[model samples]
Target: MSTIQQNIELAIERWRSESVSQHTLSDSSAYFRLAESLPLTDLDAATTLAEIFQHELTFIPTSRNSGDWFIWNGIIHAKDEKNLVDDYLATEFANALKKTADYATKYLADSTMSDEDKAAGRKGMADLYKYARSIRSAGGLNSLKTRIRYEFQQAPDFFDHDQRWAVMSDGRVIDLENVDEEPLAPCPERPVSRHLGVSQSGQWPAPASLPTRWAQALSDWTPDKEVQDYLRIAAGAALLGHGDAKNIVTLVGLSHTGKSTYINVLREVFGTYAGELPPTAIVQKYGGATNFEQHKARGKRFLYLSEPQKQRTDDAFLKALSGGGDTITTSKKGQDGVEWQAQCVLHIAANHIPEFDTSDDAIVGRMNIVGFDHVFSPESMQRNKNLVQELIEHEGSGIMFWILDGAREYLKLGHIPVPTSIRKRSQENVVESSAALMWLKEMVDSGELVIDPDAYMKDMITPKDGYAMFSRWCFDNGEQLPTQKKWLKDIEAFNHMPAERKGKRSDGHARVWGVRQSAHRESRKLHLVQDGGSTDFRDLLTQLETVPTVQ
Candidate 1:
């Protein structure tokens, strides 16, 4: 009968006919306006609007903060830092509450209201304040925070495409029209973010020009098709979040050689799923607070470090990133630390090989090195100046297909295929980075050192300890000798067996490793001896065998 009652009924009638599910609460501003007109005693009307808020949003309280609010669109999404959804809801709620409080005061002075109405108004105002306090303190939007609490979920096997979900490498896109379907059903946890920029059409025969152009860009890096194929699969692994590949890809090349261009394209397409490598990720800092640097990569699928100059790579951090099994602990400034298994594949590009603190197999085995040998001529550079943007704009869909195809291939193979170029370069990076490896490799190449495998069975200790020999070699070459412990580890990593240490200091058996001077070098020395005729290596061995030991 009253205008306020008529307006509230009209709003409800429109809600039933149009379906409140069809639009978010923010889109239906008329309902909030009706709440603004309702009498203060109309607790039922306020309750209805509050119930709509519960259906539209879910709040998750964090340990030390008010927490995050997620709203449902096609899929539930967290309130983005840049978005105003939460702000809009807060403003509307405040306005409606303010209007009702004003009504509670205005009705007190009104001559039109019956005596029963004034007494009910006073009670309603007290009840409204109590309700508002409950909402402001512990209850949020009809207790939505408690009733509908949910954790943000991740679907590693699926990536967000446009506004829908598509199975990675499968090309089957989920129809979000009915989200209550098996995988998309509204549950206690749900994926609330989109990472991929392009969607798979599931159609065959991608645009030929895309691959052709991509091949051209890659050809500038390497002429080897296997290397190109490996790079393609690496991209696929990145897109599919397959850190299980357990290898970090290093793109080594000169400027204008297309390495950064390639990385930039991936970063652009990966969007939120790709993270920039923080300084602490590669270089370890001393005496600093708990570095939250790794936290930036929490949900990322790919991380890129570009042109890091003259810094020793953090072996432990990098190993943990690609190792797949290690759980990394990261924290915010005041919040509690969170632990997660890193699923991100790292790609580091630099003009030269990156130095490392150590050169063990853990370092060698986890690296995938790709060299971009060609520096594009000024003319070629001029032509492909905007190569990355061009490829992304014109061939985005095809590129997505290419990457997904690589994911499918990687899944089928169960591992990334190492190309000859990649293997060679990766080994070179490890060897060149360690002084012990360099000295050992040089000695081997010059016929000055050889592995004595027979000594392993005989438990023979060389007259000279291998580490001592390496120390002397380092002094001769003006290189610093690594610690003895590291020397052993490096040699073992170089494919030589662990050194055989026999008996205590009381016994004559010295702690010697399994390396000795090769007969080639010894014979060469014999050739230079004037008093002694050039003795063959076989004769020298016999003479040494006949010699008496100090023991």
Candidate 2:
């Protein structure tokens, strides 16, 4: 028989002898395995591989467009012996092709073969090697990978690590091995890409009975029992990637307050799911280097920033990342951007509260500022220099369990209870950062400013005119004037909306703010007159009455 015909017979006989009693040919994988065992020509083996095995392996294209291929091992798209699935396939193909080529070459040396038979076998061997050479050429593996992407009916989900998934919606851990088995059956619509580094062991210890180092650290970091409990709850919330709280947690204190130590421990415990909080998330846009830093937050559950500069926070970015349910888009240079709901919760360790536009109530509502006031003494600080590592090394699982407990409690509560101290700190820091609001408070407190709805008919302060007045007040008081936009935002936030009027300005139309200083403030009146508003502004102030300040 010709080499091809002879090899086909040998393959069938080998399968019949070794596997027919055990498995039917209808089993595609078993049949493929039988074919692999035969000394078939390279071309035939490669074709057989394509026909039976292509569907078993999947191709996953990553964000970087690297040729990352995975194999569908009936359960998950997994790697082959820690190598990309393509690598394993190429090695297997090369080895099998070499064995078959050697077999075909040996057959050509048969002295008993007739001249015509040898000539036909030589032609068949040449054709097999020619096709096999094409398979081994450049781009061959890539072409195979491309076919997998386009030919497969179902595209394999990327980023699933086959261990832990992103925070479970119900806060329960599901065994991925048994994902389709039980009460948690009905697989997730999309695989969760992020996982906790450590799994929760069993029942968590009571708060008072936590690991000694952890309890002591918590107590030292936040002396208030409520705040201490809130810290645990926050950790739990972070563990589950729960952003529903819509709040950014800041641990504020001076050095030696154990804040850094606690955050360090938390970072170690969080493992692969935690990343350094991106500077873009904390700093003002256009003020820092951004190499698509936000993209690093992808698949992370907790993001921690240490001692960010005391600049105005990126309010919108912070809100979105902190769980406002806003979509965050990240792009690499020369690449299309990817958009997803940000699942990571941010924790900041700050020596002081970062500034934010005080007018944003959403920003205000989202602030969960916890104080780390209890300073560790010099001796204690020295002793605990290595405490964070020790805690993680020995009490890592216990800490994870504690965080898990907090997560369960957070789910049950439906909200994290804002400790009294957190509320107080948040309010104090917001007020301190807003000079516009502070100026307003000073004016109202000093009986120099009043909110009069009737002022529109008399001393109508157009929002621009209001800004001019505010500018003069800031100049006179040696306080820097905030941007006009922010000043207006603050004014509106203080419940002062703009009212429309015709024939109210030189332009004959205006949107006047709902606030004004008392007409009796002679200095403000003179300043307004001197500010070149003397023509219309002087007359407007004349119509003002000494109205009592509205609380």
Candidate 3:
């Protein structure tokens, strides 16, 4: 016999032999499994698998039970290891479970599917499992996960992103995908993606009451009004399902400044919606050279990098995340790299801010730095031993409202406005934060201006020419080379005038540069200076070096 035929016959024999116990195997499961065993075309293999097997089996119908269930019996001359053949009688009850699951998933995913169809799908899943039909599924995504996991033994990795479907703070599923019915089962592996917290359930917690104790404790402990405002913005962005305004929000301070505590509060507030808080940054793996965790942040909405000691950030990865770049390459375990848009935001809180020396515009644009200088007394913290738990459990709906309201205001504000202190702190954090800005600031301080972008220009050089000179300047200074794009963007960032002006220079009627170097004594000093006025810059760097390093 042919290999395909042999395979089909063998599968049938195994089925018949196993069902000697009188198993009423459903046609779908039998057909699906037996037909799948063929190595060749399903057409011929299925015919042999089904027809030959059915012809060999015997059915003895019972008069007592409903016709919905069939009491079919079969026997097989199966042998044991000792080659002792016997007439084996076997039995199992198989129904249209696979068909029911297929129907249920199809209806659940079909946005335009009718309510009746949807209800049938729900009923199928509910009948199969208790959680689907329970009240616990009404709030968040955890129950949804539980049901899917229970049915399929694996996690889901896709959902419908087109419809902007989300589990709201109240836990009622809202899908741009779903119209009439409430939100239903979310599979985060096909169209888009989804995730739920470990401790969260599908049921929205009891009417989201306020966490007055937590709030009061926080206010009493860290009395910085700016910190309070920032907390609101951070929480709001997380709840509203939007990226942070600053793209990357960093909370920098000594330990006990509530960095971890605040993050825990956010976790409590967001519950199942909160994402994994990684101890190290993705780029910081392998001593900040390789990205071993590119897949870690793919489906997460809120990514927390807590106490990341290393300064190395994956510029391309972070840029894509910060809205600085459009796309990022992601890698799954043993999979090829795939590109995805930045639908997620990041929060990197550390005792010491990270530094970057890269020249990518996408990298430089992701600088939202906040410093918490206050160090709460250890004695005060000791008294509130269970404060974190109390806030998470008791704060109820009050924290929800606070965060949602903050989200509303955040939408109106366009982007989170960087406080001056944060901006300065950002400058201190990175070695190559903005070389152009640093140079400009240095020149201003030294009263030795070289190329004042703010000044109107008679020298209008081409962008290409300007990059050549800038490249040389950066190379000689042993600094990160400025790309043409970053050079232009830096000028724009500082609001310099005559950004791309056309003007005549010493070579009469000849275009030079938009922001030209002045024809003066100080301008000549730029050519003479070797260290770019290192004396003053050294002092500046010294002050910035106050942040201690920890391994």
Candidate 4:
């Protein structure tokens, strides 16, 4: 009855006419053009148009569509036939429009939402637009697979055409190209025969002397129960092909606190079966390569880079560490006056966190930081010495082989979920850990592992006092409080501090300082003794206490 309603009806009629007349116009482009012509007198009109467009786009993929032509035909038919607008689609669009209108009206009336929230909302909408475009272009499940395979084949340096592909129940094709040759377990719906690997060669050659060496190493050394537990899990993760398990285990502690000793023991364990190379060997072997070549070389189960210091942390290292399921390349000079490239699995262990320049939360969120908060007492040192001797003497034993075998079997099963305690520790300070957790949950759902959902939630959701300490540290360092956008900056500044300054001091003897950027100038101003200090540093503490809190 209203002018706006009449205009909408008229617009719909015009769209139907245009669609039937010329079958060439893209649904999205046509919608945009129609929206431009609409008399959007209020926020409701704009919201209504957005909702309708979104619904129309979403339904196009779900319909019986083949290639691009089928999609175009469906769009044309839907636009032309007034009766084609189902009740369900119409209701859904109306609900979406109402929600948007409500939000706009509330914001106009109260102005309570911050500019930052508004910006985030806008960005989310933009991302949604891109997602809609991708879904539309793909058309259907089979089309999606064809597109994916085509993309994979076109990948630069992708040498292995003999890769196997498995179609998931959700219609996604998991390409096993350049991945380990081990056959994956089949899902319930899929036939077990579908889970076979490309290399039909029953089993790859096991490291000939691995069993003997592992037994000897285990016999010679005595590891603490907790450390041994971690090692077993790591080894199992490696053998089972859980890439994260074999990559790197950061042993954090003060100097001479057995961090290096632990690594040496692990090396000895690995050395029994295969020749363990130093960090330099790994760096040189796969540092320069095309993305596809790098992916192929990454077939190896494990890599170890030791003591990656502040200076050693760079974009290349960060990319290699964080971006799983992606290939990376570094250019190098070849003997034949041509460029060369190498690729391998990136496993790195650093004494300190990486110092990155950007504020991209996604980058840092990919890392798993395991803290070694235990202190090294005199008793612990004596125990370490005894273990060292034991490992040296017992170079080969069945008990050690059995242990390695168990670990390997556990990893291969890939069904056992990571213990709650371990997952919690790794997930701390990492946002993308949510995705990792989801992957773990999927494993549980697939009956690969048993999980106590409540326990897992408690481990991940409940914040501890340590989060407070981290928050205070960020505040004292003149960084923004806990936020996804400022995570990298906080990490960079934290990593730059001296070892003593990394942890909190009850005595107030430790001091943390940094430079704070000023709006008017290019240079930053230095802020020293930024937190409350001990009586020994009373004057500095008093001055620091005077500074305003960031409320």
Candidate 5:
């Protein structure tokens, strides 16, 4: 094979791995470029392609520009943008042809036809579909009169311009398809096919006025300006046809805090585009490989969980998903777990933020915690019962506009910076996450869990005892052992003391590494006083303030 041809094959192999079952000629598309390098003219390109690739070749000459672009199977091997607008258009055109094939099959199956008529129709009018559209003059499906507007005609802002917009964690628009859409499958004739919000259908018609009233209502509803913007941005992000966002947004608030109403508005605005990943019931509470598989298999752009704590969500799924990107072994029930790109933008609402060993920065880094202190009692919600529906259905498009604008901004900045209040609360949650760590730090400070410096002088403490103490601390805190290695490193870094030493377990079986108090903690404290440092989180070990351990 020629070098370029070999390059084509390599690219197709990669596409095959990533394409899942989308085995359309378009899906394995590096092969499309094969025609581009050929010395033949544009007219000859199609002939050469047909000659080279025999795998179910079907071609369509577009109405707009006949000479330039033709659909070879589902692949639009266009020379330039003058021909191909976007992937959506290419896919839809292929669907229209696929539908025609089904229609032909039905017509050919008609039993009432006379024998001569049937044979003649087979060779004539029906078979005319073969070359009827291919002729240069009579533009097949592309006939301006016969053309379908299709969804690609909508969103001139997105398609006309190269810029992409998506939603952020707070549900606003920023900028940024699943692998799983069958290439040859018939897609419905709808404008907004890819990312339809739960209560949406067709393209969102921009109202005479953008939904400023919803913003006003939200302003009236929320005391914090940042949170209101956060909500708006998150909503816009959901409108994002695609997203690169990796953070999970959770609204933790008191009862009747408008969370339900707010989320209901999102449900109405987002429509079937959202759902819980792994589904709430399909996931086991404690967690298993299958639950992780379900998560990996999740194909939604927006996965909504309205108070999942009520369902007793699985902790393993929560932990794994929070720090996603693991090429997890996932499969359909009885099948072996196949690797899939884990990409679900989670939007969660709950009364309490479910802590998932959040002390470690790895897990903490992925969290976007929004504190919802505002409460609208049931009577208050009852008084304004229809407000949510109006905001969602009527004023919703305007709000969608608001989100779209935010999405545009997000594309530029790359990320929406979480408000400081949310960050502070998250930090507090982390420190307060572990009662055992809190107790261990307290006991160490108070000389109760003292590590003798002289014992270290003898060089005798095992890592196992050190981990045991760390584990025990987690038991006391009601948290998992987040990062034993990090904890040891922090102890040595913070106190300037030896946190670990060569020692033996209490059991007479073997000598193991033990969690010895760092020798440096005392020096770091001394250094704190020597310098102008006021001991305001001077050491990571001492960052957590004392929590009452009455239990």
Candidate 6:
């Protein structure tokens, strides 16, 4: 037979011998006896056999240390001879006796074997390899347990040492030294604060009744033709739902030009009986809550931020203000080394347009700019003041409050459709002041207001003519003017000329024609006077307004 076949036969014979002798010998003895019987002749054969048999040898080093065991193949060896010999004596004798009995039975069977029986014998030899593998595995388990015990004895304080035995009644044996005996304290739960709706005490009182002074003021007031026209358009736009009418109205102009006063009058007319305050105060009172819940609780339909500084406009602040419904969170360190988050709403207002440094355009688009003119006469200012005082006195009495309240209610229904024209205008002006004018023009075109076409044309056209004339004059007079400022200065100089030759310029030697600049300057300074030099141009504009002929 070949060397491999011979080794297979030997391994089978050893397995059968060990299996029968297992009952007679101690577990450790059986392992040692099998190792001794393993075939080891050629170097390769010896190594393979040693590896297969190593698992059966139980090692108990002289130092009683787990690390001292030298593992060969699957078996463990120790430097101590006493442990090796003891295990061998206990297991080898019985295994030898069993092997002797198996050999006797096989010898007898081989004598009576035929050609068919010879084939069966060869198959049995192959099955013996499996039996040898099983024996090796059983032996390895016993060796591992013995090594673990030796390791524990060597280092009683070993971090991973356990003295649990499977033979105990409960199958558990605890080492008293390994127990942790400290008490653990329980933790208390923290209380959390819940937010309640707006407090009754925090709300401003509603007016009991409309006062009488408001009516007298509105009736007695006679606004300048220009001022009246602007107010009428503003009111009509609001009534007709043009642009962001009920949303936010931004009055932008020079500081002393009555922007604040204009806002005040609007507040008196719409907020007096409604118990609404300006946007800044409202934001402050609610701790800057920008959500729908807080706004609804505070009974706010409109938010107003007056004269916000340029520095205050930031991305976070603008996002909150521009109906983005975003909150701003600021982290602050607490006394206990913890951080906190504070949130607030996004409403804002400013005296000047926000600086261009901000990267967020959402905030800018949501705001609308109303340019206030500084050309109001002294008489117009008096009339506006009287109208405002009267509205204040009649506070809760006027129908205007009801009208504003109705508008708010309508908006709350959430189905207010934006007309296509209005939407287009809003889109154009969302980033420009030109949107406000477009909104005004659309409102007039739609017949939302009772504007006298003649009066509006008269106001818009006459000023445009004077502006054009002054522009031409600057070009003719060798003036280095390319901007409005230079042209305005020249107009002012011409206006101060003597009345006798208002349209003439004296250049020391002789009088020169000054029709254009002089006409513009004179009309502006004197007021109510038309620049007659442009009568033909004025007629053309009038004809265009009156007749709808194709140009």
Q: Which candidate has the highest lDDT of all?
A: 2
lDDT of each: 0.58, 0.59, 0.47, 0.35, 0.45, 0.34
lDDT accuracy of residue 143 in candidate 2? 58
Question: Which 10-residue span in candidate 1 carries the lowest summed lDDT?
Answer: 151-160
Model 3 C-alpha lDDT versus the unseen true structure: 0.47
Local lDDT at 534 for model 1 = 70
Off by over 4 Å in 6: 1-247, 255-258, 265-302, 327-356, 381-389, 399-403, 406-409, 412-551
> After TM-score superposition, what is the CA distance of residue 341 in candidate 1 from its true location, in Å?
2.1
Which residue window of length 10 is worst by lDDT in model 4? Answer: 68-77
- Alpha-carbon error at 309 in model 5, in Å? 4.6
Report the Cα lDDT for residue 262, model 6.
47
User: How many Å off is the CA of 10 in candidate 1?
Assistant: 14
Q: 1-551, model 6: which lDDT tens digit per residue?
A: 43323443455457546654543322333333433444312232323333444433223222323322222211112223223322332233223333543553354355545656544444443323333333245463345334333322222112111111001111121111221122112111111011111111111122343335543333223223333333334332332222233233344555545655544554444331112323332222235443221222121223345655434234553344334444333211221111111111122234554333233434444444444435446676434656556544544324343233334433444323333433443445442332222323343455432223222222322323333433444345443333444333333332333456433323332221122222343344344225455457546544423422221
Error of 3 at 458 (Å): 2.9
The alpha-carbon lDDT assigned to residue 385 of candidate 1 equals 71
Q: For candidate 2, write residues 337-436 as lDDT tens digits.
A: 6666665667888887665543455676566888877667878842467887888767776787677677778778977888877887786666566677
Which is the better candidate, 1 or 5, if ranked by TM-score? 1
- Tens digits of lDDT, candidate 4, 21-104: 442223334334333333222233334344443322212121122111100121111121232222222323233333333443
For model 1, residues 1-551, the per-residue Cα lDDT tens digits are 43323443454444433432343322123234333344233244335444544444444343443445545444334354433333343334434555445544563555455566555555545655554444444335434233223222222222222323332222233333322243333322344443455544435434344466776676767789898788778877766654577877888888888888988877766656678976556565566456667667665777888765455555556677775557667655666666666666778888886666544458556778888887778788524778888887766667776766676677678778999778888888777777767877886788767766454433433434455556666777788766877776665556645434333221455433555567776665566453456756555544533423322
Q: TM-score, each model? A: 0.69, 0.67, 0.54, 0.33, 0.48, 0.26
Over 341-454, each residue of candidate 5 has an lDDT whose tens digit, in order, gives 333456777788855532344444456778766676666632387877767666665665565555655555666667777777765555445453454556567653454444
Q: Is candidate 4 or candidate 6 better by TM-score?
A: 4
> What is the number of backbone collisions in each predicted candidate, taken in the order shown?
0, 0, 36, 17, 54, 14
Best by TM-score: 1
Better of 1 and 2 by lDDT: 2
Please give the ranking of all candidate structures by lDDT, highest first, separated by commas: 2, 1, 3, 5, 4, 6
